[model samples]
Target: MRKAIVRVADLRQQVYDNLKERITRGEFPMDHKFQEISLAEELGVSRTPVREALALLVRDRILVQAVRGFRFPEFGPEEIVEITEIRLRLEPYAVRLAVEVLSAEKRTALAGLIRGEIARHGEADTWVAAHRRVRAALFAPVRNKRLIEAIAHYEDTIHFMRVNTLQDARWRGLSVGGSAKLADAIEAGDAGAAEAAQATLLGLARDSFLAWSAENA
Candidate 1:
């Protein structure tokens, strides 16, 4: 019975992870209506696990239950701004916490992320990918698993929008400078400066996104 239970739990997690990745990569469009039966058929799995995984995504606010099936939720300006607001609150605190534990080796690695970003500035797609790497490096020093999880949850909500922001040359420049400033603060072990750097960049991103939302709306 225990072995059977483990298999079921593992299957559910696999399905959940798979669906999240597919959604993130735009395989599942916001207008794409899908149900457990179809997903199970496509994934060659039982509907039970698919249903459970869909429920989990719904609980995470990453998916919406439609009348006929499930679909990715479309974010409006308010929803997008709110997602950044949550991050703005949680991430700086995460950074401050990280300062207490950031090791010399980790600081070196994080500084390397800025240089990598500089080297790839000419590529649009790489800027997005590199920014993601910078985020992962910045958060690596935080020892609180739950805080890290919270930040990651909010980050996932705006992954595509972050990519969009980095698509612009001006935004990309600001972000590269921000990464350098962040590395300096972290290397100096200045928690206050680190927190300020995080908040300032995020504030700029939030403002930039809002402006884009208005123009594109």
Candidate 2:
């Protein structure tokens, strides 16, 4: 991308994107302290804009300010289960809408997304990339932009937790199988099956996260 001539400050957006990506990738673990002065100095930015960015993350519930400083929010087993349950209820419905309204070209594009994911499966960052593609396909056909915007933020947060859960061999297997099942259900245009598969996949996520939290806690 070419540099713009005149506009809003690029540094702040750059800082925001970098911080958000790191947080999402679990580089900043939950409850890990975030030193604002250090980060501002490292990023070669003023504390003012960095403060703005941190506040944004806080509003998103991705980060929180503790007694000492700002840090990633820690989620327990119950919270993980609750979030997954909500996703199970909502995402399937979105997928069903996508299946119903997707054009032939869009469907082909989604198929290519699956193929792309298969090729990248061995890479360290592939799971999160693959998930974003799969999710975009599901919500692409939905007409409500407002609802999509709202859910997309939460989906990103959930994906962060999921990446951690998938580190387990058992959870990885469940994810692979569930993804295949969801793709097949979408291809078949079976809304009921699609929703069921989504629910089952989320159930696996919920159970796995809960178990991990129990062990860790």
The per-residue C-alpha lDDT of model 2 at residue 30 equals: 57
Please give, for residues 36-155, the per-residue lDDT of candidate 1 as tens digits.
Answer: 988999999999989999999899888889998887676787887788789889999988888767777776666666677767763465677677767777788788899999988987
After superposing candidate 2 on the true structure, give the runs of residues whose Cα lies further than 4 Å from its correct spot: 1-7, 122-125
What's the lDDT for all of these models?
A: 0.78, 0.72
* Model 1 misplaced stretches (Cα beyond 4 Å): 1-9, 25-32
lDDT for position 188 in model 2 = 68
lDDT of 1 at 29: 40
RMSD of each: 3.1, 4.4
Candidate 2, residues 1-217: lDDT per residue as tens digits?
A: 9987876766666877899887765575555787779889989889887888888778878777877668767776667767776777677777777777876666656656665675577234456556656666667778978768767777666655666777666776677678777777766667778778878877887888777777877
Cα shift from native, residue 115, model 2 (Å): 4.3
Clashing pairs in 2: none
